[model samples]
Target: MTGLTDLFELHHDGALAENYPRLPGLLAELTAEELVRAGHLLSRVDADEVLAAQPDQRAVTTVITGPGTLDGLVAPMTAETARHGLLLRPVLAGFDSYVFVLSGDDPEIARHQPDLVLCVLDPSMITRELAVPWEAEDAERVLAEKLDLLEQLVAGFTARSDATLVLNTFPLPHELSAALVDRRSRARLSIAWHEAEVRLLRLAGEHPSVVVIDLDSLVAEGIPLTEPRMSVYAGAYLSEELLVRYAREAGHVARQITGLTKKCLVLDLDQTLWDGILAEDGPDGIAVGGGGRGDAFQAFQRVVKQIGSRGVLLAAVSKNEAEDVRAAFRAHPGMPLSEDDFVRITANWDPKHQNLTELAEALNIGVDSFVFADDSPYECGLVRRGLPGTAVVGLTEEPAWHPRDLLRDNWFTVTELTGEDRTRGVKYKQEVARKTFLSTFSSIEDYLRELDVTVHLGVATAAQAGRVAQMSLRTNQFNLTTHRLQHQDVTRLLADEDSIVFTIASRDRFGDNGIVGAVFYRRDGELAWIDNFLLSCRVFSRGIEQACLAAVLDHAFATGVHEMRAIYRPSLKNAVVREFYPRYGFTTHDHDDERTVFRHDLALPVEIPKHVRFTGEIERPVR
Candidate 1:
């Protein structure tokens, strides 16, 4: 009655479904027993009702299977999905049937065709059946067999389905070490166990569709690796606390795979970035990097820069004068970030929320893609209320812990990092220069001609699969069919003889935008149909889409294809491109409530944009 139950009682009609949104925030205040009780309470609520209450809900088909009783995880996992505005349509696998389910032995699970699959293995899976007095060689043999089974399962699942496979590195049980107490025996056992965990972590790197959760890291955070009593009686190897944390990590991966990841990190320049206020502490008086508390602020800045290097845009909103902030950056030698590191720096008297809106506009991204961090609670509250979609990180008074707090939710987690991600900040900085030059000319054509844009449009190489898959996921606005694909899927398409996977990249007088557009189509004798076509929103309104589509049509015609058909599936964000195909003389072939198909005859050639220049399929930077 003191924790979630009390909050439940306070709700109208004592309905726990109404409290679903607040459950994640109240987790820290709950005791272990209360957390278990809360999970049970959440499990009783109708999932359909909770999803109905959410304004923006994404339903992911999930399947949970392991070598033990995992029923308890389904509830906490459901609650975690609710926290992120996601609904889980889970297919329950048989208990202790990890191999059977993963090996394609279970027909229901195999046919379920889930979007996210969570498979957790515990130490007992290997230890319980180990031979007595097993030496290092014997341990290695068993580990090899288990690894083979896992690899086979992973390969089979990935080959058959596009769902992401989530695995975990299990902690070594104490029984293994206790049974082998001698120094030599203990050393061998420990080495073998460590090698096994390392091998498990390598699966994530080997398969683009696979993600591994490190249970050892969770245990390092003071959560007990396993509940002995539960393991002995209920066959639940993972403790409830560990399961809750594991569910959170799984939720992060789900968000990333579903294209709900944050794109930018907006910071406050006062006490949040530095140790003190610039107005009161003076330019040289502030603590930045000399020693003591200043080093903490410096460390925080270093972490922010590292994050920026990974393609997350950095921005700042400060109420101080613009010159004062600029002077502070110049005066501080220990500052890891310069004015150029940020895409936008707003230093004015406007409300922080208004500045954030303007920052999103300037960057050509949505407010929801931002993660705003401020040391002041008032400012955080204002942004939270003003833009409910933006993730707000309220930093405490301690600057040393700011980095940990900011990344607690893993807002920018990605499955794979590409060259474009590493250099995104620099490209945005170049965009600022492009905008400034655009204002100098009244005619758009003159501005484009002066900019000197060069585009690369051709069959995508195997090496460009990651960038194409990334574009498929993140390019929503200009996406023709809105198909979300993974790297493995793109790789598969690249190998098909009948399918054409092509990419488009643009570089102007400013900078290279990387692989900004892609098209997936299949050829059938003399006919072709587009599977999906998308262009990055950053290149919109620059005639890149027109140029790219023209090239695609011309290529199809030259290939002896008589007609090319394209589908336009309307999404909430892609209304701007609804009439895209029709502008190029494509006639409507079929129309429905959900989608429209347009067909183009290969009788005439499509004209490329005159202002833009086409280049060979090569990736090179002007700088």
Candidate 2:
């Protein structure tokens, strides 16, 4: 196979610039061997052009590879990462590109402090005796040894480093044995190997820091597993095509880790939900869920259902009449999703973008948390242009590929599921009820009074840490400071003697809205500095923010804190709370480009809201 040396022989530095522009057309025509060679050469320009334009603004990610000739794999991974960086430039905020650090097998994982650690262990790395495994007795022994080694490595990495680990499960060889085994004789080696794979896949569930990428399934799904010479020269096992997809998936993991993941999927009806236009064909004429042409729609709906189970809120923003859409969902026999599944539904004939805006408002989530999917290019384009924050997915004409296309973007991936996730669908369903109840009240205070709301301001227990961390990541609009934290980080804050971490949960006549606020404060002598102050938008405009601040201040004062300091670092999405601290009686002492500092004298009495009843220690802020 043509190697990197061959690429060097084919093109000198002078030819690189000329060939770069024609790179796309050239890739399709290249053989597997030549593609590998091209990847090596592409590595030479590691953001050379991208960095020349953006300069010193790349998102830094470190890649710790497993045992093998993996050094050769670095260039291809970097090239793929650079391409994705360009695709995700808008999502990355200030970063225009990504620069990666490729470390050897098992360097000090904690010392590196990488944003992500890609665990690229191959089957050979686990057990070298696969080829020599015609012997029956060594099979279980081999599997056990491999499992122990794998678990030890993962456990150690997680214990030492907080970096999100993306572990690739060991893939069984396409042809596992020399011949088919007679199961009556002994345990089949193939069966043993398959069991080992299952055990490897289950590691993600046991650990909070791991996201196992199933390369085995990727290959089975027909991403061609070709490795010509790179495995020999560079320890790389995947083909160029497979490697490209792997890197894309890796980038998705990285995006989710950084809180860049979208929260909601706003879908369209008509051809999108069924085979025919609902308005033109009428409800009965439109094809859905009775096999034949509607099979594709059913398949797509099933995928949407699966995603919702994993905690992505589903909603419909269609142009059809509300009654027609309701009837269509009710009439379809095999419809995978019901109206109940959707957290919000805007079925009227208003502008799709306006419906999306209303959905965001009703859900109390930012517009950027949305992913709008529609079969029509016109409707998708409207939302994309009108609501710049929402992710607009372009659909192909073929309905069969719709679900696959949606999955390709990797909008929702989290390292761990929180308490909030398990009940997210229920909470969002309840939110619709809460939004309806809001319109009945004359004023915000009256609404709060009528709901019989109660606020608990106490140090969050270990069990509630995950939900607190989630609010820190998802609460952008009402967040005083946009500091993204994970559950482990919140745990660390709790252990610090000088830091106070508080959790807020509110329940009314509607339902138990799980822990929705997190505040982290650091004690400095007689002063308490607020590091993060956030409340879920679900409880917004209800004087809950006032109640929260008053609780925090009262606690500080009781602890002998002379003054309270807070920093409000504004972001593009957090402008809604730009003046949040000032509204709650915090006096601005310093202002700068990065953050605005506010100070409150703890000696001064705080006013508690009349609506919310308190449940924990400390007096309700004095009126």
Candidate 3:
């Protein structure tokens, strides 16, 4: 089989459309030589050439600058962005198109206000004391000063704009100490580097906009010192290999910040999870623990478990007998996974792709949200070719590489976690029960009333800010504008006196559905505009949407606003809600190929659904 790197050489000129989305996966397979070659080739391609070749590009503006010589970085980074953009184009309505202004020449980073401000720095630029820390008289004091400078740089940018700032952390050199004991201890080299990394990370946590790339974490042994010839001749302080690696990693970070994160991880149970095929080698006979290849499988399972804990839904799609697989989840003493960890488990006689489609519906997430990992190339190929939206990982036959292969890609990347993230898996599992309960009811209206749905519509509270932001990020199916916002944006809206944000939380007899829907609108002069309107697909097929819309209309009427405007920007995933406004008596005020502008006259009466209950005793029922 031809390697992924070989495939890129044939299609790097943007000649193929079907191959664009697969470039990021192929880029990961490049050898050091291939990576450098690809980087150089990309650097030569101009933005106009890139645009002419691929008109499907999403215009993403960015300014990349740092404290050192980033001139050589411009071309390679641009190439990486173009390729990464092509990969993300299909999934992200459009991939980011980046244009750069040199580091010192143009410092309009905060002025222009681009989508991303990527700051890259070298470890060699650290405190002079760090270079010879073993003999420095005041190493600790010098280190503290350097850290303060780093903090100021990050804090200053965050204060200027809410745009994402991805700053690379300092990498520690292994040669800092000859003794392993001293290197691991509170000695000068270890303390200086480790404390600097910790402080930068803490600053990142304080602001939602700051994202530290963690070069320190990506390379544990630290990056190799620049060769004397390359440093002098080419003005390069880092190896070409490391530079190519960092470029790819940074590209992944950009995707996450822009809300291009995957939601679900589907796995095959046989050789993928454990060492042996389950039915052939019974639960006890399966190679699961000790010093065998089973140990490698254990390591891979731990990584998947860690991701699940963070919020990614885990599912099993295998051809084993249903009861046998359930028995393994229960009986396998060495299994790190439980039945609770998986939201959907399909172990049946049907084709794997058929099971995956049902899983996507049950989860209420797009097929694009899934990343399937299986040991069989045939199975992985089946899903990749049949369902192009789902990202597929063909796990290596060698067990040791499983974890490394999966984690290296960062498929489920997110800029930051919300309060709802930790409970995401639990909520989906509860959804399984919700599906079963709905089956017990006959009529649609009766089922909704039995749900006893309560939507609290008003200004959102501090606790609901994360969920409000999450609704914007995750609700593409029912979202009108597709404006993905972070919690800080929601917080700003809540603090603004003119803008009002509404949150809808539902609890059926089932359980607390949490905050599943939200809206942001403002009254300007005599007209009120809907800035964002989104509802989670989990709450679809109920009267929740109609009730939410009615409440928004009533709220606008109470504000003494005469007219209302709603906008819809077309995207592949949001097609379901295209005709929503016109159905509710909204007139088409303006029309375009990409967006439709709808206006509603507030003089007309609003029909609030009777099924949805309201809390906080603030209901101005218009019906």
Q: State residue 19's C-alpha deviation in candidate 2, in Å.
A: 24
- The residue-level lDDT of candidate 3 at 19 comes to 44
Kindly report which residue stretches of model 3 are placed more than 4 angstroms away from their true locations once superposed: 1-36, 39-59, 71-112, 127-142, 174-186, 221-225, 437-442, 616-618, 621-623
For TM-score, candidate 1 versus 2, the one ahead is 1
Q: Write the per-residue lDDT of candidate 3 for residues 48-153, one digit (tens) a residue.
A: 5545555444445566655444455544454455444432211111111111232222344435656766666555555334544344224456667867776765
Query: Which parts of model 2 have CA positions greater than 4 angstroms off?
Result: 1-60, 69-112, 127-143, 179-187, 429-452, 587-593, 620-623
Query: Worst lDDT window (10 residues) for model 1?
Result: 614-623
lDDT for 270 in candidate 2 is 73
Best by lDDT: 1
Compared to the true structure, candidate 1 yields what TM-score?
A: 0.92
Q: Write down the lDDT of every candidate, Cα atoms only.
A: 0.82, 0.70, 0.70
Candidate 1 Cα misplacement greater than 4 A, ranges: 1-56, 131-138, 616-623
Reference-based TM-score of each model: 0.92, 0.80, 0.87
Candidate 3: residue 318 Cα off by (Å): 0.8
Assess candidate 2 and give its lDDT.
0.70
Worst 10 residues of 2 by lDDT: 90-99
